[model samples]
Target: MRSIVFASGKGGVGKSTVTLNLGLTLAAAGKRVVVVDADLEMANIGILLGIDATPISLHNVLSGENEMQDAVYAGPNNMRYVPASLSPEKMERLDLDKLPSAIKKLDDSSDFVLIDCPPGLGPSAVAAIKSAKEIVIVSTPEPSALADALKVRALAERHGVKIVGVVLNMVLGDRSEIKKEDFETVMEVPIIGLLPEDVEVRRSAALQVPVIIRAPGTAFSRAMRLLASRLSGEKLAIQETKVKKGLFSSIMEFFGRIFGRK
Candidate 1:
């Protein structure tokens, strides 16, 4: 599996949201995707997917109490997930040395392993960056998120991890004026996608579904799908797909109503 970790040094920048959406987009295209919640302190990917945290989790796998395979929970779009432990105290005592073995098992059977890492420069986040072949940094358009994103980007480079690109979330209305040149200058990495701030994203999560599935046609969904395609080595065909109906067309209609026909 292609190992990619979604990371951000700052919290509340929507790292897990982006990771899960990308996984769902890829899985819908027939890829075997597995999402691992390496964010030990605040593991909410399962919750976002309406999955209840089980007794067996990442902590158990890392502690050698159970095989990683035994803890994976199946989800929609042929995607699978492994939630972090319910016990934060026990989670703090995670064995980093055992992490690699558990991740490798996920790699063996899946087409992609998307890790949702914890926020900050903690051990769990570091271990995830080490395990990743490529890191997709998720950040918002806000200045604080940008500063933290740069720090995370530097950390990934220091570890010799390939930087896949940056995903800009919580975008403002009308992304047309958000110059690509400006973003690249500030980020100093390829701006792979820009997810507009939309209620659809949160509503999709509330409904236990990926935004890409719910609103594939919006500027946000199109950007997400484009990112997934790029990761899979496919050329960006945003316009052609945008011109098509059904999948991509459905979501944009709803988005237009909310953002004043943007």
Candidate 2:
């Protein structure tokens, strides 16, 4: 089994979102994928997937109240996931050092164990990184996000972890955004995927469904599937889907329709 961690140096870069969608995509393709919400402190994978409150979570496993298998829950697309508890007390008492053993136990039945690591180089993120054999760094096209992504790449290199590749998310195609070539040059990592700034992404998030399922033909969804196929070492003949309008353009069109403007 391959253990891959989705990490970012800063929050709100869509690390968890990407992890969930990618897991679902891989699972749909007949891979036994297990996604673990390794962000112990601010765990939101459960909430994102609309999973009900469970009696067992990663917190239970870490605290020795239950085994890692007991915390496993069935998620969308037949994917299995281990969600972290949102309780502050549970987060405070979590033994991060035990994470490696718990993660190792998942290898028996999984083809890919994707960990949604917390943002930054915190204890939780570090533990998740140490547990994974490979890492996928997620970042936006903005300068600040790129800077943070470089930090994450450095951290993985320092630990001798293999970097699968970098995923550039929320690509608006604005001239101000950094070019893909420059980003690859600066980060010293190949770009595996580029997801556009599509409104479908926000709608999927609000609906608690992955965009790959909610709007499969959208630009973002297609990009996600391509990324999944690449990671799974499968060559896919995915057709290019044109993005009609970006998030901002769509918003402006909404107001234009309201005012009856051409």
Per-model lDDT: 0.78, 0.86
Give the poorly placed runs of model 1, Cα more than 4 Å off: 173-179, 235-262
Write candidate 2's Cα lDDT for 2-100 as tens digits: 999999999998999899988888888778989999999888787677555578999999888899999999976778999997667786567888999
| Model 2 regions lying over 4 Å from their true place | 236-262
Measure candidate 2: CA RMSD: 8.3
Clashes of 2: 0
TM-score of each: 0.83, 0.89
Error of 2 at 72 (Å): 0.6
lDDT of 1 by residue, 1-262 (tens): 7898899979987788888878877877778899999888777776666554477888888777889999898876777888886455656557887876788888768999999988988888899888788899988776677788889999999999999888888887455444555767987899888777878888776665566766777677877887888789975333211212332223444335423476
